[model samples]
Target: MADEITASDQIDEITDQQFLRAVTSFEAIIVSQIQVKNKLGDRLNNAIRAGIIILGIIAVSLLILLLTLSSQIGRISNVVGAMNQDFSTVSVQMSEIDTAMISMELRMKLLEGIAGQTQVMDQEVVAITADLETMRGTMAGIKSSVKGVRGNISNIAVSIDHMNVNVQQMGYDMQRMGRSARSLNKIFPFPLEY
Candidate 1:
């Protein structure tokens, strides 16, 4: 009976040792699994935080770009508006220029009419100049005749009224020539007698 009791006690002790070893190994496995899960959770949290920071930076950059673009758009709109205003002013000025051109056309017609008459005026001036030369020759002949008449003062006064009439005609012609010369105030565009 004592031998059987000792063998049973030894068997019980061995079985209890095996059970404790198995339980300790299972506890160790459970602890390692919990550590792995914690590491995975930390990694996921870090990745989420990094993603949020990148998203924030991107959002800020987009906001800045939008602001800058809006500013540029506003400036472009102002420039376009200014150009439109300038074009309107230019259009008004163009209308005024058109009116000026019309006035110039009328002036050009008047100048053309005057230019046509200038030739007729030139021939009249030549005729008048020829008459002056004839009168000068007649005056020279009269001077020679007067010089030859020594002490014939009675013949020099051949009716003062007749001489006055001839002198008045010459004076009228000279006045007409003077008026024409004043109107044509050019410096020597054609052959002119001194």
Candidate 2:
């Protein structure tokens, strides 16, 4: 009976020590789990911050691109407007050229009439040679015809002067147009040979 009681007391002591060891192991496991959770949370926070920074960088880049494009468009519009004014000037010059051409045509017709009159005077001089009795009257007619021809020549000189002035103005306008075109070529996507 004494040996059985001592065995029973030893068994109770072993059970109490086993229960203490199990409780300590459970607490250690809980502490380790909390540490892992804290590390994971820190990693998630870092990833979120990195993503936000990248998004901000992208947004700023897009804004700069947009502003540059807008400025370029505005400059193009101004250039186009200036070209329109140049074209308008060219149109007016063309009209002036047309007027000059019409005046030249009228002068050419007058010259043709003068040539006919000179042919008539030649015939009259031949008649004067053949008939010496009408020489005085023939001389008077020739003198008046010469004076008319001199007046016609003076008018022709004035008309030619006007035509020259108009032509020079047209040339000036063409040069201005070329300058505008050169400026406009800078904006083209491809290189211009001219």
Q: Highest lDDT: which candidate?
A: 2
Which lDDT values do the candidates have, in the order given? 0.60, 0.61
Task: Tell me the RMSD of model 2 versus the true structure.
Answer: 22.7
- Highest TM-score: which candidate? 1
lDDT of candidate 1 over 1-194, digit per residue (tens): 99999999999999999999999999999999999999979865865675576567556655655665565556556555655554565555455555545655655566566776877656655655655565565556545544434223333333244445555755675565555445444422455455
Residue 174 shift from truth in candidate 1, angstroms: 99
Give per-model CA RMSD: 43.4, 22.7
Angstrom error at residue 184, model 1: 99
> Looking at candidate 2, what is the lDDT of residue 56?
71
Candidate 2 lDDT by residue in tens digits, 23-59: 9999999999999999978865865675576557556
Which segments of model 1 are wrong by more than 4 Å? Answer: 114-194
